[model samples]
Target: MARKPGALRNGAPFRDWVLPAAMEKVRKRLKTVDDGDRQMVTILGCVPGDGITAVEAACQEALD
Candidate 1:
């Protein structure tokens, strides 16, 4: 079946802000939950992964 425009099919594009958007929440959370002075680091060798939607959903859940 043909996928929708934003469908997470093979080769579908994920946004540039996916990681940054997620990390922004993490930064705020860390400030409240952990040491406010500590910095968080994430390493992504690839730009877009197969599970981008799941990650986005998780970030949204964290913000809520």
Candidate 2:
């Protein structure tokens, strides 16, 4: 059978490609740690639009 555009036979392409790429970039931007540095990591996500911006700002503040 023929498949539709952006339609995967199984699972989600965005989850495999887009999310991983974005996360890799985020990880690369993270600061290095020393023995005294904490190793805590937090992730915040929200739906597109103003909600996402708000969540991102909150994450930045928390991370900072």
Candidate 3:
């Protein structure tokens, strides 16, 4: 996949702590979900070699 414009490899602009905090937030949110919903919901964390980090829902559609 092509890289997004103006993106840093090491997760710039945001503080270094932001990625972990975001993952934790997603985990916390999923914890409160029902068992069926929880099965569908997933938190994905990506740490690129360039130092870029990302966290996002992997199964939003399933949860919905």
Work out the TM-score per prediction: 0.32, 0.29, 0.32
**Cα lDDT for residue 40, model 1?**
31
List model 3 lDDT by residue over 1-64, tens digit each: 1233212222465324344444445544655665422331223323342232423332333234
Evaluate model 3: give its lDDT.
0.36
Best by TM-score: 1
Judging by TM-score, tell me the better candidate of 1 and 3.
Answer: 1
Q: Could you tally the backbone clashes for each prediction?
A: 0, 0, 3
Candidate 3 weakest ten by summed lDDT: 1-10
Better of 1 and 3 by lDDT: 1
lDDT of 1 at 7: 27
Q: Give all candidate RMSDs, comma-separated.
A: 12.9, 11.8, 12.3
- Best candidate, lDDT: 1
The global Cα lDDT (0 to 1) of model 1 is: 0.43
What are the lDDT scores of the predictions, listed in order?
Answer: 0.43, 0.37, 0.36
